[model samples]
Target: MFESIKYLQKGNQKRAYQAISELDIMKHLAAYNPILCGTLPIGIDIACSDLDIIMEVDEFERFEEQVRELYGNQQNFKVKKLHIRENPVIKANFWFSGFEFELFGQALPVKEQNAYLHMVIEDAVMKRHPSIKKEVIELKEKGWKTEPAFCKVLQLEEGDPYKELINYGKNTGFI
Candidate 1:
């Protein structure tokens, strides 16, 4: 899955730069691919953009410990274990140098790192439907709460955006 997708570097200039910088820090945290995902990676991120990263870790305990050692003591840092729809992951959210950062750790076997894969497929969608980017940006400005809902509201794709994108990725041999 990691081999099929490449890191994207085409988003909000500042956010993209921060993503790149954070990737450097994340590299020492995970032996597997440390991926940059979400709005910032696809260029529709706005001024209030927050960075999202996905790391595949061999040892969740060790990895989490390393992450804690790296940023747990930093000002404004907050960490939590999250389980969305039965998927287990760890999230670290904080403000570093005034930029919002959200890092997620995906334990081995990696289940379906949705946020990570979502951004990958979103990249493909953005490339195929350039106008959709405009719609997404507009919805974001209007405070749309989630990407799948936003895509449905904007008619960006048929069926569930998440499922569609995941299927698209699999069919295209990209995930």
Candidate 2:
């Protein structure tokens, strides 16, 4: 259902952020919910303490759905509406719902992304560095800044994330 659930947390920071970033990018690419939540630069600043979102349809209805899921269903995610110049792409504000995070955006074909994302997340969660996730959770609980090292291990640059995401997806069989 929700691709976010595909991420199995091994309790590492780099892994969590890797998962977060991967999912965030995937949602945006999918454009299922154009705007990603929790990524506003003008909001409360904390690299390890903010949620991000990407959305489904119109911003308003999207908001309502998120609310219903959160309060009604007891979810752990937040929201924000980001209008991206890229047509069909919307990045929004973000928040957490327990371990389940949500980010929505333009429809980017995810079959490819999912595969690579799974591999990236799988390697991080199951091998390579398992502690990154745990550290992320610990730092998150303590409300401290933490960065994902997996991207670094993979040598990913933060700018223009689409290409890297596609590579991951294609390599991993999500496509």
By lDDT, the best candidate is 1
What is the lDDT for 70 in model 1? 80
Q: Which 10 residues in a row give candidate 2 its minimum summed lDDT?
A: 36-45
On the 0 to 100 scale, the lDDT of residue 40 in model 1 is 63
What TM-score fits each model?
0.76, 0.35
Look at candidate 1 and tell me the lDDT of residue 107: 68
TM-score winner among the candidates? Answer: 1
Spell out the clash pairs found in candidate 1. 11-43
Candidate 1: tens digits of C-alpha lDDT, residues 1-175: 3332234433336545654466456456546566666676567777787767677755667767877788787667887787765767778787776567787776643335777667766677677768777777877777763466445644557876777767766876656
How many pairs collide in each candidate, listed in order?
Answer: 1, 58
lDDT of 2: 0.40
Q: Kindly report which residue stretches of model 2 are placed more than 4 angstroms away from their true locations once superposed.
A: 1-55, 62-79, 84-148, 172-175
lDDT of 1 at 160: 65
| Superposed Cα deviation of residue 18, candidate 2 (Å) | 24
**When superposed on Cα atoms, how far off is each prediction in RMSD?**
4.0, 10.0
